[model samples]
Target: MTAAKHIELMSVEDYLAREELALEKSEYLGGYVYAMAGARNAHNLVATRLLVELSKRLEGGPCSAWNSDTKVRVRTNGYTYLYYPDASVVCDPNPGADVYHDRPVLVAEVLSPSTRRSDEGEKRIIYSQLPSMKLYLLLEQDECRVTVYRRTAEAFDLEAYSGLDSVIPLPELGIELPLEPLYRGIENA
Candidate 1:
């Protein structure tokens, strides 16, 4: 007979404490910590471009754009999840914790092959639980494509944009992001 493996879970306090001194970044979900993988050049380029654009557009506004180093806290189904999105915009910043943002108006993830499933499935579902989140973006690294989820009175509205000439209108934050600049210098993107 095959033996079942036992998984030891870490507490939220311990996880936070460890993260304070850890050399690398890891996401906390429930009671488990998942190590983050290093991003590729394409991923970095895409994420950086998005961050730059968001920062420029959000300047002098209530919302501020943050890089991947900023963690977002989401609580749902009796579990606390701390995710490091590729880029995030928070109009209402949490004053209690400097390391994480509890209320983010927009969250963006540059999709990669290694993390596509979780980003599209698990992360998407969990992020929706945040009442402050109004927009979610899934940007493709290898192509000029983006999947946008905008919150409505009833539910989230899904939209997809492709091609370099396409533009994404984010009226929630009063910003319009063009795909040409986002995928600039990215070959075949």
Candidate 2:
């Protein structure tokens, strides 16, 4: 007798329908529902740190900073996908009522050893599907380096900075963040 192979997962909507009353948040994608993973210590620290600064800078502004609790909806070929980045800033608020944001201007994820690949790879592609997104930022968990992806008329281009002396520029929001204080107190990070 041969072992049976598992069937592929369902779409984002189907997964959500099945787990209507579930406690944990789920990210819906093509035939898959990824249980929202709790961040590692370093992940939590960096995310919190970034949010604090960004929030302060964006206070009373048109842009709002949302934690990972917010889900970004990506629509492609009529398919809808949901992903939760560590932190995101959105100018639009019409994602849904009592739910996550749909159209975001900037999305940032702190890259860990586990999530580094996907956060920098697959998520980038999915995020590009959103026309509202202008910048996608990736923060390294073990270092003070940051990589920013900016969308241009032609294509997206990447710019990298290491340490606090470097500033992360968000021309879309007319803001530039000083990287030095964001990485303070990161252990071996």
Candidate 3:
């Protein structure tokens, strides 16, 4: 029976402006902004290992790997979203001067207890919507496990690998990540 609440929806420009001054990174979806959670040691270690490996392998090539701070802009069904993956690889020769990357060939997320559901569900759906995404990796921080979603002609195929001997191959980037090295610094606590 009371008057409905009215709130001003934040535009992408407004979000970008706040991002510069804010202490922490946030994800913008449509008109809502959500603060990012801090990562634990295992999460950071895994993400760093992957980023370092990808960066080392992609050196001097047309492709480049980025850390989690790089934002990826996605527009799906009339809604604009800005998300930061744990690691991303962009193969574009001339990516325009934007604060976010829209043409990432690979996006990887190191799964934590706080982000598992959203990463596996919402993020999986959104990242796949991008035509430039060739591979999406979800890595477990507690164990040596990886879930890869590879894009085919019209859909994505799922693959899982575990143990220290498995190697994840990404033909798109002409590189392979061995499970041992990726999980080298992580420890169970």
| Candidate 3: tens digits of C-alpha lDDT, residues 1-189 | 999899888999999999989999999988899999999988898899889889998898889998888898889999999999999999872355567898889999999989999999999899898889999999999889999999999699999999888999989888888888888646641
Which ten-residue region of model 1 has the weakest summed lDDT?
Answer: 91-100
Residue-wise C-alpha lDDT for candidate 2, range 126-176, written one tens digit per residue: 998889999999998778889999999988999998876788877798778
Give me the overall lDDT of model 1. 0.94
C-alpha lDDT (0 to 100) for residue 119 of candidate 2? 85
TM-scores of all predicted structures: 0.95, 0.88, 0.94
**Model 1 / residue 56 / CA error / Å:** 0.2
lDDT accuracy of residue 45 in candidate 2: 83
Clash total of candidate 3: 0
Give all candidate RMSDs, comma-separated: 1.5, 2.4, 1.7
lDDT of 2: 0.83
Instruction: Please give the lDDT score for candidate 3.
Output: 0.90
For candidate 2, the C-alpha RMSD (Å) to the true structure equals 2.4
Question: RMSD (Cα, Å) of candidate 3?
Answer: 1.7
Model 1 bad stretches (over 4 Å):
1-6
Candidate with the larger TM-score of 2 and 3: 3
Question: By lDDT, is 1 or 2 better?
Answer: 1
Off by over 4 Å in 3: 93-97
Candidate 3, residue 93: the lDDT equals: 29
The count of backbone overlaps in candidate 2 is 4
